[model samples]
Structure formats: structure tokens, C-alpha cells
Target: MDPHQANAMTTLSLFAHARALTAALACFGAAAIVTASGSTAHASPPASKKDSKAMTTSKPCPKGNLERSQCMIRLLLDDVAKTYDGSGGGGISAIRALNTTTFAVSLPQEGRIDVLTYEFELHPDGRVAIKSRTPSTQNVGPGTGK
Candidate 1:
């Protein structure tokens, strides 16, 4: 085997590992922010201790603009998971701040077969007010390309 090929393989493995680690870290950060901040998935906070633990705590956004934006994005991901069907598992592909209160986020495809992107408008408070489900063009994938 060529030394170049071996190097390429190792590089690819490292890249994959890095991506996995980043995903895991993001999930953990979001969970901590949600759990410790008092954000709830339901209408209101749970009354009992057991039920309270089940709820996502919500707190005011961080004072720093950078921290606040990150918090909002994490909260938005939690909201997106509610409508996601566990397809693709790619998570959020892109997010753009359209305005002070509105953001356009690109969602992962429904399945591995399709490369479609769904864009939605999410508020800074993590409330989804608008959603667009239009598929773009035919996605090209390995072994499925024409």
C-alpha cells in the first residue's frame, strides 16, 4: 500500500472522530443549558420534584451577546428535535440571523436518500414561528447518482 493512501486513511479517521466529538459536546452543552436554565418542553413547570426533574428549566438568556446567541441556538435545536423523525441524524446544517428577532435555520434531510434542506424561522427565544418544507433540487449521493 502507498504511504500516501495510509496517510489519507488516518486523516479521514481523525476527521470523523473530531466530528463525533463535536456532536457529543454540543448535545451535552445544550442539555446542561436547558436543564439548568429552567427551560421546559411543556406549557409550564412541573409541580412535584419528580415531575420537575422531567421538565426542561428555563432562564433568561445570558447577558453576553455571544453567549446569548449560542444559548438560543441550542434551545432551537431542542425545539427542532420535537418535529424531527430521527432521520439522517445530521442535525442542524446551517443557521443565519435574518434579523434581530428572526433566524433562518436549515434542517437535516428526512433520510439519507434525500439531500433536501428544510428552512425555518426561529425566534431568539427558541420558539419556532415559521417553517418551510420545500425541497430544493434532486440531491446527488454516492451510488445513487445518475
Candidate 2:
């Protein structure tokens, strides 16, 4: 083949190779990001033996002999789980009573290190409602830690 034609062919080959490499790299980068985000989406820690035992030992307050506050907390946690995760998986780690009808709760969410704090109130219809919520990393409300 002519020198000019050979060089042109080589250039085209190189361009094609480079384009294929770029596409492959982009696909790999996108896959990596998806994997990372998927991993971070469910950021709750694995349950330890002690934590598992604590969960098992603590029965649902209505059927068992647990305290009223404990039962209400369990129900609240269930509600939060339903609202946030669509499944009954998450649990509140800490709860502090603001008053007989109001309280603050702290729990961890997927992809976050800091706990989320929410103010909760018992409605007149016997339903629990979250009044307000704030992230714990910022200087916010009372239930601020893990």
C-alpha cells in the first residue's frame, strides 16, 4: 500500500481503538459508581450478638409485659421503618421523653454516619407523628448522637 494510505489506515485504527477504550472506561466508571452507591444506600451496621440479643429480648410492648413508653417506642420505630425504608428493619437507638405526649428519637439511616434526630408527638387519635427532623452532624436538637 502507499505510505500515505498506510499512515491513514494506522491513524484510523488508533482512533477506533481510542474510542473503544474510552467507551469501556466510561462503562467501568459508571458501574463502579453504581456499586459504591448501592453499598452506601443501606449503611446500617451488621447486627452483633449483643444487639441481636437485645432485640430478641425486648418484646413488642402490647402483647408482652413491656412498659408503656417501651411499647410506644417500638411502635414509633415501626412507623419510622415503614416511612423511610418500606420494610420493618430500622430501629431507634435512643429515645428521650420531651413530655408525656412528645419525645425525641435518634436512629441511623442508610449511607449516613451520623444519626438522624426527629421530634415525635402522640396524636389525639393515638397515632404517632414526627413533628420535625434534623441531621445530627449539624448543631441541632437534643437527640444528636449515635
Candidate 3:
């Protein structure tokens, strides 16, 4: 073959290789992004408001005690205010139980008193049970108020 023709073929081949390589790299980058997005989608939901506040404000509970008791109190108070139409007339009270931690608040209005008592029981799995009691008896979920 002529030298000019050979050189032209070589240049075309090199260009093709470069385009293929670029396409491969782009595919890899897209795959990585898709994989990361899928993993995040499947991951656990974001922390609740109470959980975040607890981590930020409360001291770490002992290995055998309730975790973030102070934060729990704040969360409960906020819940009470929301539930009672911004009428949070309760005063918070805390006491150490025989083998647990107890927090109580009294909401007195007119002639009715609503008591919110949270009994915290720490388990081996590092979860706390915040049992809230009102005059009508409502159970809030773990790590949340109201």
C-alpha cells in the first residue's frame, strides 16, 4: 500500500481507539453513580427529630441506662405543646427509678390534670423505650414523642 494511505489508516485507527476508550470511561462513571444512588436509596431513612436532638443535647447514657434522656424530655414537651394546641402547661420532672429512669410532666388546666410519664428501659441492643402516659393513656413510639 502507498505510505500516505497507510498513514491515513493508522490515524483513523487511533481515533477510533480513543473514542472507544472515552466511551468506556463514561460508561464506568455512569455505572458508579447509579450504584451509589441505588445503595443510598436502599439505606435506612434519616434520623428522626428526637434522635437528632438527643444526640446533640444529652449526655451519653451509661452502657446500662437510657440513652439521651434529656433529649427525650425535650421531645416530649414539644409533642405535648403540639398536641394540646400550644398549651404546654406541664412542668417536667425527672427521677431515677429502682432500676430505670423516669421522667414525668404534669399538664394542669381548668380542673383536669394530664400526666405524661416516660419510663425508660434500656435494652442490650442500645434502644430505649419511652413509655408516655396521659390521663387518657397514649403510647408514643420508641425514640419519639406524641
Candidate 4:
């Protein structure tokens, strides 16, 4: 093979290797981001044995269980909003807890006034289970409600 041709082939191979390395790095970076976000969303304080017993026997919030629940829901909703993409105008608006471990969140979609409801289950082990449902649009007449 000509010396010039051999040198050209070597350079091409080097460029291909570099491209592969770059792609691998990009994938790794994406994976890291996903993992970090997931961890942040699920991170919670671990309950000790005594705390677990207290939780089981403790009385519900006296001020108003619903209000207390709403406070917790608001915190979770805030986190969701922070993580959500706001460029599309689709994100969580409110949240309500139906029970100690179950809660629902309201999400607004792009170009729509209706809020979608989502259910989430909070586990003692810092795990969160989320379920999304189809959203219905709000109906409004032409002249507004004058």
C-alpha cells in the first residue's frame, strides 16, 4: 500500500474511535442525570423502629387532617414542578392526600385549562409509586361567564 494511503487510513480509524468514545460519554452523562433525579425525588428520612410504632398509634393531625395532608402534598407537588419541563406549560398545579400513604396531584397540560389527576403511593423505604391518568379538557362557552 502507498505510504500516503496507509497514513490516511490510520487517521480515519483514529477519528472513528474518537467518535465512539464521545457517544459513550454522552450516554453515561444522560444516565447519570436520570439516576440523580430519581434519587432526589425518592429520598426521605428513614423511620426508626420506635418511630414506626409511634406512627401506628399516633393520633391524626388535630388542626385538620386534610390541611396537614395538603401541606405534605404541596411539598411533593413543588418537587414535581421543579423537575417538570415548564417550557411546554405542562406541570403540576396542586396536590391532595387521600390517605397516609396515597396522594393525588393535579397537572395542567399545554394549551389546556383542565388539570389532570395523578396518584402516588409513598412507601416507608423512601420509594414512590406514581400513576398517571388521561386528562379531560375544561369546557367553556364563547362569551365567558358574564
For each candidate in turn, the TM-score is 0.39, 0.29, 0.34, 0.29
Candidate 1 residue-wise lDDT, 1-146, digit = tens? 44333222211001113344235233433222221223322212212223333223233554443344444444344444434443444444444444433344443443342222333344577443334433333354565443
lDDT of 3 by residue, 1-146 (tens): 34333222211001113333233222322111111112211111222334544222222233421124433433344344334431432222111122234555444333344455555555555444555544333333454344
Compared with the true structure, the alpha-carbon lDDT of candidate 1 equals 0.36
| Predicted candidate 2 versus true structure: per-residue lDDT over 1-146, tens digit per residue | 33333222211001113333233222322111111112211112222223434222123232221133444444334333333431221333334444443345544334333344445454454444455655553233455533
Query: Runs in model 1 with CA error above 4 Å?
Result: 1-26, 30-58, 110-146
Top TM-score model: 1
Q: Of the candidates numbered 1 and 2, which has the greater TM-score value?
A: 1
Scanning candidate 4 in windows of ten residues, the lowest lDDT window is 31-40
**Count of residue pairs whose backbone atoms collide, per candidate:** 7, 0, 0, 0
- Residue pairs with colliding backbones in model 4 are none
Predicted structure with the largest lDDT when compared to the true one: 1
Residue pair clashes in candidate 1 = 37-57, 37-58, 38-57, 38-58, 39-56, 39-57, 39-58
Q: What are the root-mean-square deviations of the candidates from the true structure over C-alphas?
A: 13.9, 25.9, 28.0, 22.5
lDDT of 1 at 109: 41
Give the true-structure RMSD of model 2.
Answer: 25.9
Better of 1 and 3 by TM-score: 1
lDDT of each: 0.36, 0.33, 0.33, 0.33
Predicted structure 3: clash tally: 0
